[model samples]
Structure formats: C-alpha cells, structure tokens
Target: MNYERQPYRRCGRSGLKLPAISLGLWFHFGQERTLHDQRAIIAKALELGITHLDLADRYGPPLGAAEEAFGTIYRKDLRGLRDEIVVSTKGGNPMWDGPYGAGNSRKHLLATLDRSLKRLGLDHVDIYYLHRDDQETPLEEQVATLDHIVRQGKALYVGVSNFTPERTAEAASLLRELGTPLTVHQPQYSLLRRRIEDGLLAVLEEHGVGCVVYSPLAQGLLTDRYLDGIPAGSRAAGGRFLTASDVKPEVVAFVRTLHDLAAERGQSVAQLALAWALRDPRVTSLLVGASSPEQLEGNVAAVDRLGFTDDELAFIDRTAKEAGVLA
Candidate 1:
C-alpha cells in the first residue's frame, strides 16, 4: 500500500471530488468469496486512498448478498471511518418476482433504497443511481424519484447507469428542470467496447455530467489472463456471465498485441487498459473489481503511471479498429 495514488477529479461541475481509481463490489464480494478476502481487498484499497466503493442490489450470486456483505464490513471494520469513504449503491434492477419489484417507478426506487440502506448499515449513501433506464416508466417519473431521493437526504447525489445517449440527455434535462443536478453516468467503456464513444460521451459532455465507467478491463479479457488460454480458475472458466465462447482465437491474437504494447511500456495489459479509459477528461473515475489482494495491488499500481503519448493513442485507435471494436 506504499504505492502512489493519483489526484482526485471534480465529478463534472459538482463540488464533489472522486478518486481516479474506484473499487466496485460487483464480483467476489459475496458468499462465493471469503469474508477475509473481501476485507483484505477493501482494506488495501482504503490504504491506497481509493475512497469510493461501488455496490448494487443485484451484485451477488444470489441477489442482495453483496450488500449484506458490505453491511458486515461497514459495521465491523469501517464504521468509524464512514466520512472518509464514498459509498454508492444502485437499485431498479429487479430483485424479486413482482411487478413493482423493478423499474424506475417512484414506488420501486424509494422502497429499494430503504432496503439498500438497511443492507449497507448506513443512514444514507453518498450516491444512489437508477441502475438502468426503465423504458416503460416515463422519463419525468424517473427524474422525480431521483430528485426525491436527494431531497429526502437518503442520497447526497443522483446518477444513472446503462442508459442510451437519448435517454441520458432526456434525464439530464429533466433533472436540470427539477434543480437536482445529474452528477454521474455509469457505463461500460473500455478499449474493446467503444460503443459509448459514438454518442454517449458527447451526451454526457454536453450536459456537464461526469462519468464513472465500469468494465474497463472487459471482465479480464483485456488482460494476459487469456493470452494462452482460459486458466482453470479464470472468470471465463466459471461460465456465468463470461464464458469460454468469449475467448476466441482472434481475441487471443488481439490480446497478444496489447500485451506487446504493454510490455513496451513496462506495464500490464490491465494497467494499459485502465490508463486508456482514464485518458478521457470526462471520466471522473474507473470502477474496478478484484478477487484478491494481489490483483487489487497490481490494478491500483496502474494509476502510478497513467500518461500516454499521442502516437500511442493513435496506435490504440488503429488496433481497436482492426479488432472490429472501433470503426
């Protein structure tokens, strides 16, 4: 934990500042991983000045488990240092089998926030997000609910995730009308997934909303973990969300190129991928997850050296186009 940590950035025009590298409890923060492992990783992150910890209602093997685990950590290890951390949680992803259990309806979002608070063992969270756009629900209702969450003091700031450019723009406009500023937009963006670069980035920039992106490593495919083949205990081997079908020969060849580039820079592919994502000035933070302390340490170290030359960025763009991810 003696390594260098990067500077904090303003979340858009908001007065709040977030670390360049944030930790997401999306994976391995559940019953599948030991409590000791979770504590160690989180402890290491805190020691390295990674102040933000991201969570969601549907993050565990079974829903709600990750929040419960976080509650344990909050009460046991991090209770006294609450003010030093930024805790963000999302709802509206459908936790159960009822009509009202999902969507961005005021009923679903408000009720889910209460449950999320209980699970996190907190009176309020720093940020609460609408996990995804509820197409069925009108944009006005979604904005109102988010505004209400802030007004009630249950969440300090409001955000949205997995939303299209059009929807994001609409939500931003609505939130502006209500005087509740949209602080952040969480999306999946990486070298391999440049879909956001098309319009999403422009939408966010136009609205002055910051972005805290996820999957910058593309679930570990952007790393050397799959260079030769799927290791026995790799995420692809688990076959849950990512599977063997994802690790094709073409992907291996592409990863090899990334590996070579990273070697030339004396960094890991994971580090290079993160640096590339952080290059965006609108990207307020990078949400990363790790299964072990070693992985966390290595990933956090990437922040120590985050600069990329003009030639390197151009090369990455060309390689991404060649890989069919960008055009």
Candidate 2:
C-alpha cells in the first residue's frame, strides 16, 4: 500500500490518527455505480493511504445498499486488513418505515447500528455518528444513546453531523460526563460553505473534538468544471443535489478566478478549495468522495501543498464575498 501519500492527523485528543484525506462512501457505493467500480475506488483509496471510510445507513439509493456492498468488499478484499482501517458509519437518518426509523431515540440509534454492523460484516466500528440532530427527540436521550453505543462496544468513538455549535457543545459535555467523549464532528465545509466558520470549529476545538470535514469541493462548484460554464452531463446539469439555479454568473466568475489562483499554486481548483479548508489547524481530516481512482489520486495530491500565503487567503475571502457565498 502507498500509505505515505498523505500525512495523518490525530482525531482530537484520541489516539486515532486519520489520513489527511479520507474516503467517503456517501456517493457511488450503491447501485448508481457497479460493485466492481466501488471496490476499485475503495482499493485505490486504501492503496493511497486513505484509511477512513465514511458511510451512512441511508446513503445508498435503495438504502442500506452502501453498507451491504461494503460488507462484501470487506470480506472479499479487506478482511485481513481491517486492523489498518478506521471504518465509520452513521445512524438516525430514516432508514425504515417506523416512527423510530429516523429519530435519535435509544431504540432507533441502537437498532440502526446493529443493522449497520450486520451489513458491514463487523463486530465494531471505529466511529459512529448521529447523522443528524432530531429536534423532536430529547437531546438528553440522543446523547445518552451515543454513550450507550460506545459502552456496548458497538462504536469505539461517537460523533454528530449537521449539528449546530450549541448542540455540539452540549452533546460533548454530556458525552464527557458519560465517559465516552465525542471524538469527531463531520461538517459540510468548503470555500463556498462557510457556515461552520461561525462557531462549530471553535466548539470542536474547545471540546477537543476533531473535525472530519465533508463536501470540501462544495458539490463540484469549487472545481474548474464550472470555471467556464456548467457543462452538459455535469452535476449542475442533472439538477439534482446541485441545481443549475445554484450556479449564478458571479459564482462562475469566482470559480474562474479561483482556477487561476490554483494554476499559480500548481494545483487544481478543487485542490485549492480543499487545501483552503485544511488551512485551519483545528480540522483533523477531510472526507472526500470520488467517482474514480483518478479523481481520488488528484484529491489526495492536494495534501502536497496545503499551505497558503496571506495574500492568497485574502484574495479568496474577497472573491467569496464578491461572489456572495460567504454564508
């Protein structure tokens, strides 16, 4: 395995050291891509030093397919190498039809994790996340469920995704009281999505919880693909997760300028966006999704040049403001 491609960072105060770029099974780990393709991408990632595999119970198009398929890959390709991997999956995101199917109740969280384990063909996962915050459920119960999962030996550590700074801090305190400790936080972070800059990063830093950031490419917007215009057969063209309406003229202009900055730095536009996200020392790792091995290789290369000049950061900030995406 080419494990020296990227550096590893400790996940907060934990002993776990995650690769600078981790692979996410959030996309194409299901029927949208063939099992051969999924296995190949995963193999390539592992070969390139990406040991963290991020997933969710509701990730696949038919739900649970992602985990089920990864189980097959694990047994076939990685059973003996499990010790080298940091496998993670999420629950509490509506995997079934019952009222408990979606909430963070103890029943839902525990049941979902059991199913996730069964599908991944593992007795335990390194990290398990509450995929979302359920306001309808009591926060105490939700936090307690995470603590229970860790105590039950289902997860080595616990985390939450898409949670606000206040909720994250509260959960951290509760988990600390329970002796499990919130290990990491997965947030949507990129040059285009600056919501976490408000307080979440600070909260994680304060609580000593590592940040595993996802969508560092901003759903393909921070790439050179949109620098000229939205090409056909692109994410924006599909009008699915990324709408064409989301791409304004100013956004395109900003991307073009960002592309030039990336060229000057000997990286792709996506690399610049990713490196920019990693500039904050508080960020532990980035959860990057790839459709192919080539894409994964390119994203991994971003680690080669993660530092930025003061002037470059200032330019990015000014462009983001001019593009009206600072939010």
Candidate 3:
C-alpha cells in the first residue's frame, strides 16, 4: 500500500494523524459473511491506503464476533504492519446478558476493554471510545475510567461516541483535568442526519476534540442503492436498523434529485455523501463500511472531489429539507 497517497489529518490536537477515510467493521463482518471475504475486504482496504480500522465489541450480530473476526485478520496478516495501522474498538453498548454487559460504569468499561484487547489480540489500541453515555453513572466516574485506561497503556487515546454537546464538554473538561484530554468524538453525521451540525461540531472544535463520523451514507439511503426503490437484500429490506417503511416515496424522489446532482459531478451518490461529510474541517475522518473491495475503492476515491460549490450545498440543504430528512 502506498500510504503517502492517502491524506491524513491530525486527530484534533492529538499527535496522531488518521487517514481521511477509515474502514469500519461495524457491519458485514459478522456470521453473515465468510471469514475469507472479511479478510479480503480488509486486505483491499489496506491496499487502498486506509490505515484506520474501527470496531466495536457490540458490532457483530452475535455481539463481539466482529472484534473476534478482526483479531484473526490482525494476527494472520496485519501483525507486521501494526505500527502503520490505527485500530480502535469501542464498548459501553450491551454485549452480554448481565448488568456489566453495558454502560459507562467503571466495572463495565474496564472489563469490556480488557476483553476487547484479548479479542483483538493486541496489548493496546490506538483509540478507545465509550460507545455511549450512561447517565445513571456519574460523568466523573466515566471520564476517570477512560483516564485509567490510557494510563494503564491499554489504549493510546480516549474518545466518546453518541454524546451531546453538553455531555461532550463535561467529559472533555474532566479528561483535561486528568491530563488526558479527550482525543475524539464519534458522531453520526450525513446530509440526511444533520443533528451534529446543530451544536456538536462547535463543542468539538472548541474543545479540540476530533470527530470521526459514522453512517455518512445514512445506512445506504444516500446511495444509488435506493435511488430507484428498495433493492432486495438491502439493509432496509432486512428490517435491521433501517426499514422499508422508513424509505418514503418522497425520500426516493429526493434521492433521485441528489443522484442527478452527483452524476453532474461525475460521482455516485455514495461518493457525494462522503465528500459532503468531509467538507467540514471539524470532521477528522469518516468511518465507512463496505461489503466488497470494489465498494471500498470507490469510497476512497471520494477524496478526489472533496470540494463543493456553494450552490451545490444550498441545493442539497433545500432538497433534504423538502424530503423531511433533515434532522
């Protein structure tokens, strides 16, 4: 892989520089996919200069399977390239049946991170994130646990995911007090999902916390996959996170308009969506998932036309609002 070809950005104020596009193992790395296929996807990602791999303990359909699958790939193919890779795993979502299966409690976080490390077959990860906030648990305790993980050398940096601006500010303040400032924030940001732009981006920028966004394609709705209609075997068809009911006729019409716009730019809707997310300087990287090598390659090419005209941005905003997809 020619690492120099991929653009790297500073993770907020951190010394680490992450590739602009990272491969996320959140989907299609579970039992539904073959091990060989999963390994091949990862191999293709690395060849495309995608150095960052994101995973979560609860990502797999059978919780924790994704990390286990990544562990196999890491030991077999990526062991020697460890220094060149930035592997991250998150916890704080339910992974088991017991009380400790989830949340930001010190016990859940510590135990899950330890188990994740063992599953990844690595002593330390580049970043460790509290997957979500546990309001029942004191914020102080959660931030302290993250600090503890960094001090113990289990993870090089700490981040938060699915946190609001107020919560992010509080966590950043606590981590800064402990001399381990929050490194990043993982939020869901896309043309369809604009909640982060309301205030989270400002909070991250003010606190110097980098942002790595997920669902940039809005679970494939922002892609050509849904431009015509819900394709068979699609995520929406599976009734998982997205559903057929969620794809209204008006939404498809709006997507067609966006698709036409993408064609004018010589890009796919997926590529346009990726570029749109990257347009914001506060976004350090995009965590994208791919089912095949070709898809991964196409996504990596989104960086080729990252810039957007003011008219394009305005049109997109107006169309999204018209379709009622704006959050």
Q: What is the lDDT of candidate 2?
A: 0.90
Model 3 residue 319 lDDT score: 86
After superposing candidate 2 on the true structure, give the runs of residues whose Cα lies further than 4 Å from its correct spot.
none
User: What is the C-alpha lDDT profile of model 1 across 174-199, one tens digit per residue?
Assistant: 99999999999999998888888989
Better of 1 and 2 by lDDT: 2
RMSD value for candidate 1: 1.5
Which residue pairs does candidate 2 place in steric collision?
Answer: none
In candidate 3, stretches whose alpha carbon ends up further than 4 angstroms from where it belongs are none
Cα distance off (Å), candidate 2, residue 176:
0.5
Angstrom error of the Cα, residue 255, model 2: value is 0.8
TM-score per candidate: 0.97, 0.98, 0.98
* Candidate structures ordered by lDDT, highest first: 3, 2, 1
lDDT of 2 by residue, 232-320 (tens): 98889988789889888878888888999999999999898889988998999999988899999999999999999999999999888
Which structure among the candidates has the greatest lDDT? 3
